[model samples]
Target: MRDTASPAPERRGGHPVATRAAARLDRLPPSRWHRRITLVVGIGAFFDLYEIFLGGVLAAVLAAQWNLGHTARSWVIAAGFLGMFAGANVLSVLADRLGRRRMFLVNLGAYSLFSLASAFAPNLSWLLALRFLAGVGLGAELVLVDTYLAEFLPRAVRGRYLAYAYTFGFVGVPVAALLGARLVAGHQLLGLDGWRWLLIAGALGAGFLQVMRRQLPESPRWLVVQGRDAEARRIVAGIEERVAAETGQTLPSVPEAENVPERRVPLGEMFRGDYRRRTLMWWVFQVLQTVGYYGFGSLAPVVLTAKGYTVTDSLLYAALGYCGYPIGSALSIPLIDRIERRTLIIAAALGIAACGLAFGFAAAPWAIVAFGFLLTVCSNVFSNAFHVYQTEIFPTGLRSSAIGIAYALSRLTSAVLPFVALTVLTDLGAAVVFAGSAVLMVLLCLDVALLGPRSTGRSLERI
Candidate 1:
C-alpha cells in the first residue's frame, strides 16, 4: 500500500515540531511495528475486560456462597464501578499531568495488586473494599488505551486498528464467562475457590502485560504536546525508519500542517469554546451508552436468572452470549474506518435496543442464546465506535483528561445502574428493562446524529 498523508491541516494546539512529528508518524503505512504495538496494548487491555465481566460471574458465586439478597448483590457489582469512577476522574488527571505511559503503568499495577488482594478477602466487606481499590486502577485503563492508540496510530488506519486492538481485548469477556462457568462450579485451583482462581489469573496476566508494555514507545504526539519536541522527533524518526524497513518502500512526504503554539490546556478547558459542546455530547453519550452496554453485561446472569434459569444455567447461558463480544468486534474492524463513527454508534444502539427486547422475552433456551449473542455483537460494535470517537474529538493536550472525565460518568452510571436496573427487573419484569434501554438508545441515536462530528479518515490533530 502506498501510504499517503492526510490532507487535513494539523492546525492549533501544537508547535511546528509537533505538527511535523505527527505528520511523519501519520504518513506511514501500517506495518509489523504497528501491529505489534496494537497486539501488546490489546493484550494488556484483555485483563481490564476480564475484570469487568468477571464481576458478573463473581456476583453469582458470592451470592450463592454468602446467601445475599438483591441489594447485597448490587453492592458487590457496584463496588468496582464506584472505584472505577474515582480512578477515571483522578488518575486520568495524572495521566495528562504526568504522562500517558507513566499513568498506564501506575493504573495497571494498581489493578493487578488489588485484584490479587481481593482474591484473599475473607468476607463481603473486605471483598468490596478490595474490588473498589482494584477498580480505581482499572478506571484509567480504557481511557488510557483510547488516548495512547489515538496518539500513536496514523489517521488512515486509526479507527480500524483501534477496533482491532479492542477486538483482542474483548476476547477476554467470553474467556472470563467460560472460565466462570467451569470454575465457579465448585472447582478450585491452587486450593482456592474457582472464583478466586479467576481473579488470580487476571492479576498474573497483568503482571506479564506490564513487561510487554515496557517495549512500547511513548506517543510522539503527546511528547510534542509536552514541549519535549526534541525527544518527539527522535521517537518519530525511529518509527518512520522501522515502518519503512518493514514496508520495503520509501515513506511518503510529510504534508504541510499549521503550527500553533503549545501550552498547557487547563482541566476546565473541556467545558469551554468548541470543547464544551463536545464535552456535553460525550457526557450524555457516555451516560446513556453505559446503560445500554454494561447494563446487560454487568447483569447478564441476573437477567438470565430472572427468566427462570438456575444460577449454573445462567452462567452457562451467559457464556454462550458473551461469545459475541470478540466476534462482533472482529467483524467491525473492516467497517470502523469506512463508516462514519457517529452513524455506526447510532445503528449499533438501535440494534442493541431491538435485540435486548428479544432477549428479555426469550423463553426457549436456544432463543435466549441467539438474541443474547446478537445483543452483545451490537454492543461491541457500539463500543468500538465510541471508544475511538471520544479520543478523536479532543486534542492531545486534553485528550486523556477529556476522555477520563467523560468516561468517568459512564463508570458512575455503571455503579448506580445495577440498583436501578435490578429494581426495575424485580418490579416491572425483564421486558420493561429492555424497553427502557430502547428509549436510551433512541436518545443516543438522536444525540450523535445531530451533535457528533465527522471523524473518519481525519488526522487526530486536525479532528
Candidate 2:
C-alpha cells in the first residue's frame, strides 16, 4: 500500500500539506491576542452603532435648527439606509476578493473621514449627503466584522463567541444615546452646535479605533486560502501560544482528516444548491425583523412623544427601551448554543409582535415603558440569534456575500420604513403601525418555523 503515514499535501509555506487548511483551523482558549483582536474589531463595530444611533438622537435637534418638515426629517433618517444598501452588496464582494481585514480598514477610514465632514455640513442637503456616505462605510464595516469574527473563531464556540462579539456593538447604542442626550439637551460648545459636536466627537472616537485596529493581524484562515500557508501557520501558532500562556491549558492539534476542499463557489450558487432554502428563509426573516426592529428603534422617542408624553419623558422612556438591547444580547450568549436558532428566532418574533401590540395600546407612560422594554428585549434577542445564524449558513467562500446580500435587503426595507412610518402614523396612528408590524412578525415567525433550517451547532461547510 502507498505510505499511509505520508504528510498531507502541504500548501506553499511551511504549513502542513493539507488540502482544506481552513477546516483544520486551530482552536485554543481565549488569549491576549484573541482578546486584543476582539477589542479592536468590537470597537470598530461600536463606532458603527454610535454613528447610526447618534443620527436618531439628533433628528429632533436637526429639525429645529434646519426648519425641516416631518417629511424632510424622515428623508434624512432614511438616507443612510440607501447608502447601506449599496455598500453591503458592493463592498462585501470586494471583501472576499481582497481580504476581510483590508476591507475593514478601508471602511473604517472612509466612514471616519465622512462622519467628521458631516459635523460641518452647511445645510440639510449637505448633511444628508455626508450621512449617506458615512453609511457606506458603516455598512461595509458591519459585514466585514461578522466575516472576520466567523473566520477567526473555531466552530465549537462560534455561536457564543459571535454573540459576545455583537454585544459590544449593541452596548454602543445606549452609550451614544446617553451621551447625545447630555450633549444636545442644552449646552453649546465654543459656538458649535451641540449636535454637531456630538457627530465630531463620534468621528474622533472612530479614528482612535482605526489606529488600534491597524495592529490586528489578518485572519489566519483567509491567509491559508490565499496560499500563504506558512504565514497562516505562524499566526495560528502565535494565537495558540498566547492562549496557552494565558489559560494554562495546552492547545490541541488540528485534525488532518478534517480539511475541506478549497474551491470558491460563486455568489449565484448560494441560491441554487443546498443554500437555496436558507437564502429565501433568511431574506424574509431579515426583512420582517428589520421592519420591526428599526421601525421601533429609530423612532422610539418619536413614538413615545406621539403617545402624549413630554419630550423629556419620551427621551427617558426611549433610554429605558434601549437598555433592553444589551440585556437581551447578554442573555442570548448562553442561550444561543443551548437552544435551536430557529426556535429562538420564532419565539422572539412572536414576543415582538405581542409586546409591540400591547405597547401600541397602552396609554399610561409606565405601561408603555414596560411594554416597550419587553418589545425591545425580544427584538434584540431575535437580532442576536439571526446575526449568528446568517453568518453560520454560508461557507467561508461566500460568507460575506450571502450575509451582505441579506443585510442589504434589510437595509433596503429600512430605507423605506421612515416614510412608511410617517405616512401610517400621520393617517392611522401608532397603534396601527405596531399592529401592522405584529402581522409581519407573525408571518415571518411562521416562515422561519416551517421553512428555516436548524443551524445551532453546525459548521458553515455542513450547513
Candidate 3:
C-alpha cells in the first residue's frame, strides 16, 4: 500500500509530480489537442523560416540596388546570425526561469516589431541594424519550439510529431522563393521597395500568430520541474480527460515513476559529469551543422547569379529547386518512428555529401537545378531528425539551457560562415566550396555513428 502522508516514491523520475505528468503524457493517445498545439507552434516556425530565407532573396535584390559585392552582402547576412547568437544564448535561459509561454510571446513580439521597423530602413546601415534586432527574437523562438514540443509529446510518437510540425516549417523555404519571384520584380507596391514589402508582410504574419498563441497551455513537465506539483497535475489531468473522450476508451494506468527529485538545478550542471561529454558533442555537431546549412541556404541564389544565370532565372530556378525542401522533410514523418534517429542522421548526411558534390560539378543549368533539388531534399531530411536529437539528449531542468548554449555556439559559426562562403566561392569556385561541405558531412556522419545516442521510442527522461 502507498503511504498516506506522501505519495508512492518514484525512484526514477524523482518527484511525484514529474512521474505522474510523464506517465499521463506518454500513455494518452494523440488527440485534437495534439494537432492544435502542433499547428500553432508550427505556424510560428513557418514565419521564422520564411523571414530567414527572405533575407537571402532580399540580399540578392540589395546587391544590385546598393551596388554591393558578395563580401559586403555577407555582412548583411552575418549581422542577423551574430544577433541570433546573442539571443539564443541569452533569452533562451529565460525560458527555463520565466516560463515557456511567456517567453514565446515576448520573443515573437521582439522579432516582428523589429522586422516591421526594418521595412522603413533608409539605408543598408539601418536595415542591418533592424535585422540584427529581429534576429534576437528569431533565435529564442527556435529554441522554445524544440523545448516545448519535447516536453508536450509522448515518447511513442514524439519524433514523428516533431517531423510533422517541422514539415510545415520547411514549406516556408519554397514559399519565400516563390514570393520573392513575384515581389522582387519591381518597386511598384505603393512606391515601397519590394524587399521592404516582404519584411512588412512577415511582420503582419507574426501579429496573427500572436493571437493564435493565446490558447496554448503551459508545459506540464516544466511545471513539475519548478515544484508546482498541483499545477502540473491539473494540466496533465485536463489533457488526459480530453484524450479519453477522443479515444472513447479508458486511459492507461500511470507507468512506474523514474525517480528524479524535484530540486533547483544550476546551469553549470550541464558542463560537469556525463553531461560534459554530451555538451561537447552537441556543441561540435551544432557548429558544423550550421555552417553547412546556413552557408548553402543564404547563398544559393547568389551563386547562381554569379554563375551567369540572369537575376530572374536565378531566383526562379532557385524557387523551383527549393520546392524539394518541404517534400523531403515530410518523408521523414513515416520513417522517424521506425528508424533509429542516429541511423537516419548518418544516412542523410551521406546523401547530402553525394548530392552536394554533384551540384558543384554540374555546369549545365538543368544539371545544377537537378542536383540542387537533391541536395535540398537531403538537407531537410537531415534537419528533421537533427533538430529533435539535440533536445532529446538533455534533462528537463537543463534542456533549454543546453540547447540554447549549443545553439548559440552554432549561430556563432553561422555568423562567420556567410563571409567564409563568399570568400571561398569567389577565390576557389563552387566545386571547391561544396567539396568542403561534403567533407563536413562525412565528418558529421562519422561523429554520429560513433558518439550519438539511441533516442527512438524512448522517454525524454530516459534519453
Which predicted model would earn the best lDDT?
Answer: 1
Ordered by lDDT, highest first, the candidates read 1, 3, 2
The TM-scores, one per candidate, come to: 0.96, 0.92, 0.95
For model 1 the local lDDT of residue 436 reads 93
The residue pairs in collision within model 2 are 8-17, 9-17, 10-17
The segments of candidate 2 whose C-alpha lies over 4 angstroms from its true place after superposition are: 1-20, 23-26, 256-259
After aligning candidate 1 to the native by TM-score, how far in Å is the CA of 247 from where it should be? 1.4
- Residue pair clashes in candidate 3: 11-259, 12-258, 12-259, 12-260, 13-258, 13-259, 13-260, 14-259, 14-260
Deviating ranges (above 4 Å) for candidate 1 = 1-15, 259-262
Give me candidate 3's TM-score against the actual structure. 0.95
lDDT of 1 by residue, 438-463 (tens): 89989999988888899888887777
User: Candidate 3: minimum summed lDDT over ten consecutive residues — where?
Assistant: 2-11
Write one digit per residue (lDDT tens) for candidate 2, span 291-405: 7887777777667656776555676777777887777888888888889989998888889999989988888878877888888788778887887787777777678888898
Best by TM-score: 1
Q: Could you give the candidate ranking by TM-score, starting with the highest?
A: 1, 3, 2
lDDT of all predictions: 0.87, 0.75, 0.80
